[model samples]
Target: MLTILLTAIVIINLLFIYTLVKDLIKHKDEVMSEPASTIWTPIAQVIIYFLSTFGISDFAISTALYPKAKWVSMKKLPGTLNTQCVIPVFVMALAYINSISVGVTTLLVCIVCQVIGAYVGPYFVVKLPEKVIKNFVVVGLLVASLLILAGKFNWIPANGTATELTGTKLVLTGLLMFVYGALNNIGIGSYALTMATVYAMGMNPAAAFPIMMGACTFSVSIGSMQFIKLQDYSRKITMMSVFGVIGVLIAVFLVKSLNTQMLQWVVLVVLLYSAVSLFMAGRKESEA
Candidate 1:
């Protein structure tokens, strides 16, 4: 079952990549304003996912892609990058469905809450000040990344063996997912934050992959449509969807072959990169 599921992941990724490449080539001469973001942003997102299941395409955009995508304004970048994520995040969620099945009730609760947040989030994204959004994103990612890193090394009591949450834990998780879902619109990636929530609550770290990916799949898919309706998105760098899939496949294999110690450091570096990058961006914007 695991093998088949994982293989399905590979196949779905390939299909997304094929479609993305076709779209990119077809429109490269027209809408392709910044080629660098097209090339590196996807790659950076996968690297972060590889090390820490952050699964955030926007982190790549803010840190790598946005710097180069000059034609895309900061206000529109969140929505624009999110549209590129819909398919890739869906593909990633499928990769973890089986693992999260043990916690079906928990998953359903999260999805319900996330849907509510995802539906309403774009409106806030439009109205909220950019500095406020950046601050929220920076603090959330920074704290979550640090917690996960501490947990990774036994610097904290973490990496719980529980596969699912019950009672208060489950209800709290739903609430957290709701907040994370809304934050997703303003440039916060929910994957790492969700992982931190579950890990702290005693769920297995491995299980975090499926749960976070699955929840965000629904949230992002629903939320991105509002971004489109609001005309806050850009289509030029959507090709990153394909490259992200490729990065996932590579990361999967490398993860399988690498030693645990080496993987730990990789995760640490990427998590810090994500946190620090957001912090710096927030500070830069606030200063201006």
Candidate 2:
């Protein structure tokens, strides 16, 4: 039953992508003014959407496979859906912060501190300095790289969410996730960070997958809708969405399972490349 539902979702997503791509191509002449648009943007968006839906659906299916935990309430979908909209906004902010932060660790701390300061600390402290922000991003990237390397080398145990959360570690983990949720405004991806935190906490890695996907989907849907409303939609984004949908369907339905270690290595390599790109971009900006 689960497999059938998942397959249906995949098929729907593929069809959605096909429609989007066909429309874009058909209207290419009218949309050609924005030559900067890539042929893949619509496709990517589609994949992101599909994957998000798939992830959420998979979680729901899996949860049904076992007896429901007392603490888990299926009724939280509405609230969860509402919260998802905030992810993209947070991601956008994180991305901007990372670009300017001087150290990646500082950036990570800043992310955590900013969230805390916003809710609990002095409002004045919430507004971090430009230099401080820059430093933090640089440090955060370094830390992320270290984490990727560690995971890749199997130096760290990659467990799932079968462990109970307790004590200081649990509290800290919760705080980090809240901060991560907030930082999604700047375009900092919460997926990798969430995965790392969950893994570090000795939780089931698979459990984190659904949570991250849910959050990402909710945020992106809201943000994308806003973009669309503001007339920010373009052929590039459209193309990416289409391809993204295709990718998601393939990933979720056809490739239901993957080698975690291999996936980790691929993700690590991608992050390393991204870090290098950011560093180089910063260098060029400084040189200019």
lDDT of 1 by residue, 125-169 (tens): 888776675566566556555654665667654558887789999
lDDT scores of the candidates, listed in order: 0.64, 0.42
The digit string of per-residue lDDT tens for model 2 on 21-102 reads 5656777786556433344334334434443332222111211211122111222212222222233223322222222222
Clashes of each: 0, 71
Worst 10 residues of 2 by lDDT: 58-67
Number of the top candidate by TM-score? 1
RMSD versus native structure for model 1? 5.3
- Can you give the TM-score per candidate against the true fold? 0.73, 0.51
Task: Tally clashes: model 2.
Answer: 71
**For model 1, which pairs clash?**
none
